[model samples]
Each structure stands twice: as structure tokens, then as C-alpha cells.
Target: MDKSITVACVQAAPVFMDLEGTIDKTIDLIKEAASRGAELIAFPENWLPGYPWFLWLESPAALTPLVYQNSLVLGSEQAKRIASVAKENNIWLLLGLSERDHGTLYMVQWLISNTGETVGVRRKLKPSHVELTLFGESDGSSLKTFTTELGVIGALCCWEHIQPLTRYVMYAQHEQIHIGSWPSFSLYCDITAALSPEVNIALSGSYAVEGQCFVIAPCAIVSEQIIEQLCTDKIKRNLLKAGGGYARIFGPDGSELTTPLAENEEGLLLATLDPASITFAKAIADPVGHYSRPDVTSLLFNPAANRPLSIKAASFIELIYTKQIVLPGSEEVQAN
Candidate 1:
């Protein structure tokens, strides 16, 4: 891996509920980042079709069809086009989108290698609050990190960072670069302090300090157009606001690396990361390394994939046919 690398965190809004249009804009953004010498680019969570803020504003039943229509499916032409853009730009891409499988939608982060290979796909283990209305949950298989030329890259969507076990699992993988993908923080700013930008941005920096990794926190912006469309009445308008782009890049020691963009502006927050800084930070306190006392306490992790159906092996059928196995209720098994 190179000693130093430049990274970009996208703070732009998607072409709201339009997958193809958002993909086109994403391609252009990737090109712009590559031209500016970025080796890797990270986009905000649910950026492909934008976050379903309507779930909080109104009934999700009305928008369910639109969400399903815009959600991306793995290996589709749309997904390939995004990967191709990454390859063409010669940059590693971390894209957050609403992934569709069968009839369910999931909050997902896709990692694309510089060579255009789909390196990893991780779904958010659990959607937050109203998000559950539109998105499905993921299993332990979704919690993973990928080893790449840049480093061991890992990503989590929105509130996943707040999960102690999830963050520790990523730290155990020795993730050198972490992406904290978030939707706009423009929801109920005055109504609650928990969803404020300060709290979420602090969580991103805390992740860097705790894991001894570089953090690229890409957050989306709730544009005026989005607010107008989602907020139909005066009460709804009061619930949601525009301008929540608080994209930031932090060092391993929890120091802000890039200058923040305005809450309403759309642009990339660029920062050059040095691996040596991670080393220095880890030297002080590596949570999963020298600083940890696993004998006293440890995490119980189950990394197996959770499948809905379990099929009987063909070998089992062969054994029965050859009279090598007997039926439990029968005295003996014989081949006819």
C-alpha cells in the first residue's frame, strides 16, 4: 500500500427517487474526484435514490412502490455501470444505496475495486426508527471489511457506528480506512438534539479515535427541492428542513483533516491520509490489539450467512439410494 493517499467524501444529494439519473450524476462526480487526484471516493448513505424521509413525514404505504422502483439490484446493468465508472476513473469507490433483493429493500454499502471488481457488499444490520418501515435488516454476514490496494476498507451506514459490537468487529479486522455513510441530518433539527449534525459528526470522529483508522464521513444534503416535495403542508415543513451536508474527514487521532463544506452546499470533502498517522495512533491505544484484555471479556461473533432455506445434500440422497443409510422410523433401509 502507498504511504499516503487522497480520498474524497461526496456531500451531494441524489436525483431524488431516480436511480438512472442519480447514477449519471454519480459518474460525473467520480470523474471529477478522479481528475482532482483522489484515489478513493465515498458517497453518502442511500444516495442512489435518496433517503425515504417521507416515512417520517407521511405514510410509507404511498411511496413503497416508488422506493422499490428506484432501489438497485446487484449485478444489474445499473450496478455494472457504476463499477465501470470506478474502473474508468482508476479509483476505489464506496457507494451507499438502497439495495433491492426479491421484494425487500435494504440499506447497503458496495465497495468497488479500482479494477472494477465488486469487492464487498454490506447491508446495514438494522434500520433506524422510521427507516424500518421501508428497509429490511441484514445478518452477521453483512459486517465485513475488504483488503484492497489502498488498505483494509470497511463501511457502515448511518447509526451502525453507534453499535459498539459492530464497530469492534471492524476494528478486529484492522480496518485502515472507514467510511461512515449518512443521510441528511435535516430532519426535525429543532425537535430533537439526538439527530443533530453535531452528534452524528462526533460519532464519526470517535470511530476514528477508537479504531485507529482514517474516517471519511460522507453525508447527504436535503435540498430545497426535496423539502418542497416531501413537506406538503406547513406542519410537515416544520418537521423537515433543507441543508444538512456535514461531510468530514478525520485522522486516526480524532482530528479533523478536511475543511467542512457548508450544510447546504454540494461538493467533495477531500483529504490526504497518511498511514503513518494510523500507526502513531495505534501505538497509543489500539482497542482490539495491545489495549484489549480478551481473557476478561470478549465478543461472541457469528459470521455465518443466514439463509432462509437449508437444502438436503445430494450425498444424503445417494446414501439412502445405495442402502448405506437407514430411515429413522424403519427397521432397515433397502434398495429396490
Candidate 2:
């Protein structure tokens, strides 16, 4: 792996509820980042068709159909197009999208290699607050990291960074590059400080310090066009203002690596990350390394996928022993 690499964090608005348009825009952004020599590009959480801000602004049922229609299925053509762009640009992509499987939607972070192959996909273990109305949950299996040519890379959506256990698990995996994907902080800006840009950006910075890894936190922007489309009344407009982007890149030492763009600005925040910096950060306090007190407490992680069905088939030997076997040229044997 190269000791230093350039990373890009996208801070722009999706073509709001338009999967095709968003995909086109995403391709352009990928090309732009690649032209500027970014090896890895990160997008904000739910960048596909934009975050379901309607879930917070209007009736959840109002946009449910549209959201479902625009959601990206794992193997769909839309997904293939995005992957192809990564391959064409010869860059690794950390794509955040609203993933659809069967009839359910999931907040997912998809990692695509420069070769256009999917490295891994992880869903949000638990949706925060109103998000539960639109998305489903993921199992422990989604909490994982992948070893890439760049380094040990991992990703988490929005509030997942706020989960202590989740951060610990990623840290334990020795993640050198972390993608903290987030939606716009424009929702309920006046009502709650919790959703403000400052608070959420702080969380991203804190994750870098705690995990001792570089954090590339990409964030979406809420445009006036998006506000006009979702906000039917003045009260709704006040609830979700325009320009909630606070994209940032933090070093392993919890220092801001890239200069932030304006809250309403739409651009890529680029920074050069050195793997050697991680060593300096880890020397003082490595939570999962020498600093952990395993005797008092420890984590139990189950990496198995939680499948809904399991089929049990009897072996030929077991069937014969039970006298319930039938051969191709022999008559069926019945139990005595």
C-alpha cells in the first residue's frame, strides 16, 4: 500500500428522488474526483435519490412509493453503472445508497474496488428515530471491515458512528481508513441542536480520535430546490433549511485534515492521508490494543449472517440406516 493517498469526500445534493439522474450526477462527480487524482471517493449516506427528508418533513406515506421506486437493488443495472464508473476511473468508491431487497429498504454503504468488484456491503444496524419508518435493520454480520490495497477500510452510515460498540468493532479490526457517511444536518435545525452540523461533525472527528484512524466524513447538501419540493408550507420550510453540508476529513490524531466547504457549498473535500500518521495516534491510546482491560469486560461479536431460512437434508447414509432410502434401480426401503 502507498504510504500516502488522496481521498475525496463528496458534498453535494442528489437529484432528489431520481435514481437515474442521481446516477448520472454520481458518475460525473466520480470523473471529476478521479481527474483531480483521488484514489478513494466517499459519498454521503443515502446519496442515492437523496435522504428521505420527506420522512421527517411530511407524511411518511406521501413519498414511500417514490423512495421505493428509486432505491438501488444490489445487482440492478443502476448499481452496475456506478461500479463501472469506479472501474473506468480506476478509483475505489465508498458509495452510500438506499438499498432495496425484495420489498424492504436498507441504509447501506457499498465498497467497490478499482476493478469494479464489490468488496463488501454493510447496512445500518439500527435506523435512528424517524428513519425506522422507511428502512429495515441489519444484523451483526454487517459490522465488518475489508482489507483493500489502500489499507484496512470500513464504513458506517450516519448515527452508526455514535454507537460505541460499533466504533469499537471497527477499531478492533484495525481500520486505517474509515468512511463516516452522513445525510444533511438541515432537518429540524431550529428545533434540535442534536441534528445540527456542529454536533454531527464533532462525532466524525471524535470517531477518528477514538478509533485512531483517518475519518472521511462525506455529507449531503439540502438545496433550495429540494426544500421547495418537500416543504409545502412555511413551517415545513423552517424545519428543513437549505444548505446543511458540513463535509470534513479528520486525521488519526483527531485533527481536521481538509478545510471545510461552506454549509451550502457543493464540492469535494480532498485530503492526502498518510498511513504512518495512524501509528503516532495509536501510540498514546489504542483502545483495542494495549489499553483494553479484557479481564473486566470484553465484546462478543457474532459475524454470522442472520438468514431467515435453513434447510436440513438427510445424508444418504443416514437415510439407508433408517431404512427409508430409495435407490435409482432399487425399490424404496421402509422402516422396520
Candidate 3:
């Protein structure tokens, strides 16, 4: 029997900064995709509450309202609601968002299992260009893949996919399915050079071929309607045009599996992939396996999550001191 599964890449614009509205739309899309037999679904980066396009157009300090209003708090009721949807639908969900971790906000993705359990919360190892001012970078612990009932799944946000070392790290973990999520290219394309949809498509395809894993690259759409409402500056408006939807799926051999939806179209790009295809592709060139030279070069990974604060129980601290001290009168205890 062939080990095959159906997957989906959701391509849509969020209800721009409206958390509840976006979630409702996301749920509806999830249900629709589920009905179409999509076993796993990948949403665009910052799909909920949407990506902060203003960060690129205006000064980071100027867009405080946009960030505060849309940023998601991890483990909040909103997150639980998403988990419930995944569980009820019996589908694996890879959800991307701008997470508010207390005072700091980070670009993060949460992998929810079919049982509604959140298996992994991975953040973007590095934010790009203007993103640095708005979000915090992730630590080594976030650079990880999860082994679930479906397979070893992993994710990277936007341009993180362009980093060679980052891609190698995921490849080293032997991920079977990789989700490459992106904010609308409209924000980056005109403002910057060479960071357009075409460039991203090549990168996603290259990742699938090099890593020998299925790649679901879900890009967001920035409609003219959104630009009209949010962008007040004429220069910013000119830069962020409509039609950014470029969601795609690729096979292990770098073959584009599904036809991408229109750049401005909102829909899911579905594809049925065979796990056996990975085996076939890797047989030719497994970068971490037959193709690697560990003697020549190797990666030193630090798998530690950065925590601002750590607390130790008073009892636990006392137990250590209790072993170190002894009564002065007791010779054996002072000992020897």
C-alpha cells in the first residue's frame, strides 16, 4: 500500500486586524477544505489578525495600533478555539501568527494534531528587514520538527526559507512535510528588489527538491479593498497593490503538484502526496544522508529555548544545601 495523504495550502487575506473575523473566516475555510478530503492544512503566515503590512510602509513606532490590536496571545481562548476546530474536523493544522508573548511579539507557527493537542510552537529563527522592529527572533528550540501520526512535520515563515542553514537544519531533522508560510508578497515585492513571488516560488521548489520533502508554500493575498482601508499614505498605497495570492505545493522532486490560485484569488490549493515519493527522491540525493560529508562539515545546534525568567522552588533549593552542610560536633557528618 502506498503511504499517501491529502494536504491543503490556504490562500486568503485575513479580515485585516480583526481577530474574531479572521478566525471565523479561517474556520469556514478549514471546514470547506476538510470536506474536500484535505487531511492536513497549512495557513499563510500571520493568517489570523493578518500580517502588519504597515511595518514595511511606515515607521514601526507609528503602527503601534496595528500590532497591539492583531497580535495573538499564545494559549489564549482564541488559540483553544483553533485547536477545537482541528480536533472536531479531525485534521492536522499548521497555523501561523504574530504571537504576543507577554510584552514581546514573535512570528510563530503552532502545529495542532488531529486530537486538538498543540504539539509544537515554533517561532521564526530570524525576522527579515523591517520585521526586526516588530517581532522578536526565535531560539534554537524553535528550529525543530514534530513526529505526529501523519509524519514528521515542520514549518518556516516567509524568508526564513531562503536561509541555507535553516533549510539544512530542517533537512537534518528529516521532515517529511514542510510548511513554508508567507505574508502577502505585495508588501515586500515593490518596496524591495528580488523578493517577489517568483523568487519565493523558486525557493519553495528548491527546498522540496533539496530536502526531499513535500512543501506547502502558502502565500497571502493583499486585496485592493484592504489597501484602500488601511493605507493612508499614497506612496505606501502605490507599493502595496492588490493580487498577492501565490499559494503552491511541490512534490519531493521539485515538481509543482497543484496549479496555483490567482494572485488575488482566495482559495485552497489541494494536493495528494505520497510519502513513498520522498523515499524515491532521497534515494538519488539525501543531503543529510548519502550526500553529506560529516567529516568535512557539520552543524552545531543549540536546542535551548530563550526564557527571560526562571524560577526555582524554595524547597528544591534547600534540599541541595541540606546535603552540603553537617553538624560541627558530628565528626562523621563533617567528614571525611
Candidate 4:
């Protein structure tokens, strides 16, 4: 609603495998940012209970129970409490978590309004490489933008920003603010030759340019404390050594709005974004409108939410009375 809004990116690691501890930390950060006039605040991917670096060190079987115990479930008391924090602070909250649903866990993000209501919930469309083994992939429904009082906001986790079609999808939705959530780059640089913090930063900047939207990229840092707490093995500890934090904010014109925090700093990166900038940028090139070639190319998008199968009672009477129906041939057998 304001001409300029102060947005913040929280770059910090979580208390590994400690759900309650991480939630408390998140609340503290949210309150601190809100006190400093941050209207919209976003956290790094898997910020709650931290990223599963164990996937790279330990086998899937070895880490399954640990992850399940730490990840959050939708509508749980913890989730409600987090929403209450947003309402109490009167700030828009965009938080990332390792979500536990039924028997599966997902890399999910929640957009909470000032009223403390969850406006949108999106899961990562596809987890990157080894992440696929730990988190479940989201459907097209998760690829969406929401209309908020501030503006149209959308989000994608880590490498999803580089997915050409995925980027186009957000651009087409006219997202004014895009949340880019990522784990530590230290996890990537050591494992692969090409991916690093520098490469990821460049991608984020370019994404702002291409999408013509302000980007709030919040990257997590692997601290020595975290390493000491989780990585008992020398190899694992070395792999997760400190300093990967790179929380930043980019303008609609693809300019850096704020200097990134030090690789090891645990704090919020805040930037004031002028709503007029989006108008100016779109006037030059609106990808969804003036710059798009709808006739030449078109994308088929589905917005159906996924759900598990359930058997329901045939009628309300059956449900209320606990009545059972018997088949014509099998009179003794009842199906309730």
C-alpha cells in the first residue's frame, strides 16, 4: 500500500534437527526485523531445523527418522504459533520449512499475511539432485503468485530461479516480489565444480533483470556451531565449514539494492523498494504483455493441488449413525 516498502531477507542457519528451538529462533528474528520496520520478511530455504546436509554425508535410511522427527506438519500448533507471531508483529511473513505431510516430507514455503492467516503454501516443484531423495516434489499448483496488500508476490527455491520455464511462469503471473530461498552454497561448491555462491548470486541478479521484479534472496550459512552440533565425522565437519551466508536484495532493474552480509554473518538484509520502480521497469519491457509472443509460444500450466486418496461414507446418515451397508451376495460382510 505504501509507495516504498522495507523488505528483509533473513540469512541464518537453524538449530539442526531441533524443531522447537528453530521455531523460537525464527520468532525472535521475525520480531527483531519487524521492530526495525521490515514490512515483508523472508527466511532461507529449510530454515526451520536447517537443511539436510546429512543427505550428502549419511545414507537415506540413516537420516530418514531424524528428518521426519524435525520437519513441521501443516496446521500443527507450531505452525499456528508462527502465524501468531506474524499477526502480533503486523508484518507479512514468508518462511521456508522442511514440511512433513502424512508420511512424506517437502521443502515448503508459507506466505502469512498481517492478519496471521496463511495466504499461500507452495512446495518446491522439483528438489535439486540429491534433495529429491529427501524431499517430495510439488505439482504445477505450487507454481503460483499471490495478490497481497503490498503487491503480487511469488517464490521459488534455490535453482528454480534458473529454470527458464519456471521463471517465465512467475513473470507471466506478474509477480512484483520474488522470494529466492537457498541453503548454504558451501554445500554446492564442494560437491560440484560449477555451482558456488558467486554463480548463484549472478543468477539471482539476472533473474531480477529478466523477470523485471524485485528479488529477495535469503541464503543460509553453515556455521561452525552447526558443524560441531551435527557433523561428528571429520569429513562431514569439513564439508559444512562456516561461511556461506549471502542474503541480498535486487531492484526491478536488476541492480543490487543492498550489500550482502558477510558469508558468516547471521542477520537480516533489509532494502527499501519503491513500487514506482516496477512501473518504470514494466514500461520499458513487460514480459507478460508487451514483450511476450503468445501466438508463437504458449505454456500449459495446471493449478490443481495434490491430495491423498480417502474413502468416505456413502451418506451423511451412514457417517452419523455408524451404519454399515451389506452387499447383496455377502449379507454378513459389512462395509462401513
C-alpha lDDT score of every prediction, in listed order: 0.92, 0.92, 0.86, 0.87
Angstrom error of the Cα, residue 161, model 4: value is 1.4
Tens digits of per-residue lDDT for model 3, 173-224:
9999999998877755655666788888899999999999999998889977
Clashing pairs in 4: none
What are the candidates' C-alpha RMSDs?
3.8, 1.8, 3.5, 4.7
Candidate 2 residue-wise lDDT, 188-257, digit = tens:
8888898888899899999999999999999999988898899999989888889999999999999999
Residue 273 Cα positional deviation in candidate 2, in Å, after optimal superposition: 0.7
Runs with alpha carbons beyond 4 Å of true place in candidate 4? 188-193, 308-336
lDDT of 4 by residue, 212-303 (tens): 89999998888777777668887786666677888889998999998777898889999998988888898999888998889999887787
Itemize residue pairs with steric clashes in candidate 1: none
lDDT of 1 by residue, 1-336 (tens): 457999999999889999999999999999999999999999999998899989999887878899899999999999999999899999999999999999899999999998999999999999999889888889989888888889889999999988999999999999999999999898989899889999999999999999999999999999888987888999998889988999999999999998898999999989999999998998999889999999998998988888889997779778888878889999778767
Q: Candidates' TM-scores?
A: 0.94, 0.96, 0.92, 0.89
Let me know the TM-score candidate 2 reaches against the reference structure.
0.96
Best by TM-score: 2
Candidate 4 lDDT trough over 10 residues, lowest sum: 319-328
